[model samples]
Target: MITAKTMATGLAFAVLTGGTYAGASTPKVKPNIVFILVDDLGHGDVGFNGSTYYETPHIDQLANDGLVIKNAYMYPTCSPSRTALATGKQSFRTGVYTVPVLEKGNDQVSIFSRWTVGEEHIMYSQPLADAGYKSIHLGKWHLVGPYPKKEMEASWPLKKKLGQPKPSDFSWVPYHKEHCKAYYPEGRGYLKNIGGTYRGDPALEVGGYKSKTGGYFAPFSNPFMDQKNPKDKWLTDHLTTEAINFMDEHKEGPFFINLHYYTVHRPVVARSEELTEKYMNKLGDPKTGQGMETGKKKLTTAQYATMIESLDDNVGRIAEFLDQKGLRENTLIIFTSDNGQNIGSNLQLRGKKGYIYEAGIRVPAFVNWPGKVDARRTETPVMVTDYFPTFMELAGIDYRGQLDGQSFAPLFKGEDKALQARPIFWHLASEYRNGTCSIIRKNDMKLIQFLATGELELYDLKKDPKEENNLALKNPETAQLLLKELTGWRKANNVPLPPNSSLPY
Candidate 1:
């Protein structure tokens, strides 16, 4: 398949060749890009997304300054969603399948390029590199698979067979205050890289911003665990400090800093015992966490509430950092999540972090770029695939071929509207190999096709926000129309046919 991420380069090439317009005055100001992606954060997790249970003051402030895509969406899992964001195309096209794929044997590693011939032009780094902007990807690299061991290729059949997760018997996260070859920030295409937990702090040497981490194992603590200071600041604080420093150093030129956070995911432990106690107290009585497997202790609605609060604080720090540096104007600060989560809060949405349901796929996205967009809400359904195109627009890059994503930049600049006729498609073929064959938002009106059972479900999102009403049989014509579009999309993208192929049967 001609992956669309690289195709967008044609757009960039054309724009660059068009050169400076005779009458156009090139703005001396070069904008910086901040792509903030959180792992497993969902529609109900933040205040903007209806999480009244906990506050999101920073996110709220961002919304005040920029437009929030009320209908922003991503795949239900990490790798595929990240792949779409990285490639601006569905996982199937890039071989991601919109779902996580695990390999127990050596026959294949699962991720498309994991088994493909040449380096799939899926990662956005190389293109951004070619664009003269410093691009960095920190935090959870769940998309490129396990860190360190997996150095993506200029070509594939990746000699580094994506490895097994290191047993997290100890603190998967440690307060290592040094950055070395193991920590290659600029080498990783990021001028700065202060990723959390799984990807240790490369900041003692490298510079960047923060937001921070967790994980689990039924037994053991690090024998060498830093007892020197039983209580060090939470890893998030360190991350933020570095991020601020990075911005301070790089504000002179155009840069892309992806400050990824590994918080609000798993292990559910606090940075310190006191904070844990504070959280436990906040949960009040505790039926809410009974029979839960949070590891350290039973959680209360309060601890969940506290964890979210801490995450919010991290957001505020980054925004405040930008304000302090006066970098808020030309910098495009985008906040989004890799997938969905159910750690806390309630927003009547069904499903959790890994399902294709709206609850799982719909994510919280707010862009705070002054003068670029208005502080309002939009119901235009945008997807992770859209970022490849959107970033190109920000960089003044033009694409020259068919792209799966339509740049929402027009909408952000006030040139478009919320409701458009374009259809967003998703294919999660890996799950079929694991169990059921499922395709979502299949029709224009939206249908779910379950190949295993030969069952189909339909809903009109306009009439039923909860997707409770079935309209497939009630309106077969609409269903068929949508199915046709979806099938064509898959076919055009070279997504395998179902069953015998990588698609569904």
Candidate 2:
């Protein structure tokens, strides 16, 4: 059977020689791309997304200034979602079903030992490099798998089996010696990767160096970050400072900067005591809103609210910088989150970060390009994988590779009807709240199948956005049709089918 990667590659090649895929009117020059991927932000976290609690003035303004994709979706967790963004392929193609957590054995690892973006697969930066665009990565970089300790170098398969690519491959700079020679970002696709180490910060040990300090704060347990930062310095402010500095240096023409912030994830560190108190007063004593699966009324709401406000403040800072540099009109700003909210967020949407439900997969996304992308709300279903092709298309480069995602570049120019019926797929072999499951969404109808018990659920998202109704048994014909498509896609992608242990045949 032909793999999904091969099929996507063939399709990509077929469109390479084809005319401008962005439709009749393509921009004369490529716009600077600044992608801001927030960590663990939920669909209803921002003000524009109907969050009655958190304050996000800048994010709301950004939505007012550009186009908001109502049906944007990402992987339930971090690694696979980011991998999809980087490679434009699904987990089945890149072998990163989730964060690379291997259950080691004495002799052999699981047949599914494959993780991390495969060395051969084209990264998002690689295509942009040929287009004369300098790429920079800042903040969280969970794509490179777990950081290999110096002692584990000998056994690190990421170093031997799948070594890192060259610097020209993407310009990932700040490649250090402690980071296994082949595992550095400079050798990949980023030109400068400040604080862009494997996994999110506060991970205790980074690049073989252990940080004994607190996480997220100035005294962070991250080696990539400076220990000299003022004790009061916040990670969000520090990263925004680095971003502004980068923009100051590279605001001339075209550049791609991936500003992946590690805010609102864990530890829920607030930027300032004043802000925390401010939110506390505003939210009252109880600080009640929507909480995670752990239960409602999580006291962490004030801290989470303050954290989101800080993120918004930084967004304002960037927007102001662009205006000051006169680059606002020509720049393309894509903002969204990596996955769902943490264990204690997501208002109306069901489930939290670790499930394949609408709340887990659906995220808030917007694109701002001044005169290019008009300000409006579009219900077009966009996936994390679509950004790769969209960016390449914007750069006037034809991407002929295996991509599970297609370009929605036309949507930027107010083309709302494009990609109307595209099917977005998600698979998580790793365990989560809903257990091992796979999902496929075509139009408003969604089908989720559990791998452990072969249980299936069908929901018409249009009628029931909350996903309270399971139409599987009630609508047998529609369920079977979607089931057939889902199973066929699994087969085509060579996905492993779950065993029916309960069968009494």
**How good is model 1 by TM-score?**
0.75
The candidate that achieves the highest lDDT relative to the unseen native structure: 2
Q: Which segments of model 2 are wrong by more than 4 Å?
A: 1-27, 102-114, 147-182, 203-213, 230-232, 284-288, 291-298, 415-418, 498-505
lDDT of 2 by residue, 154-268 (tens): 4532322323332122223234444443444555556777676664434443322122222566655455666455444778888888888888898886888889988877756
Task: State residue 234's C-alpha deviation in candidate 2, in Å.
Answer: 1.2
**For candidate 2, what is the TM-score?**
0.83
Q: What is candidate 1's lDDT per residue for 206-228, written digit by digit as tens? A: 11112122321111122222222
Error of 1 at 53 (Å): 1.0
Report the Cα lDDT for residue 498, model 2: 26
In terms of TM-score, the best-performing candidate is 2
Please give each candidate's TM-score: 0.75, 0.83
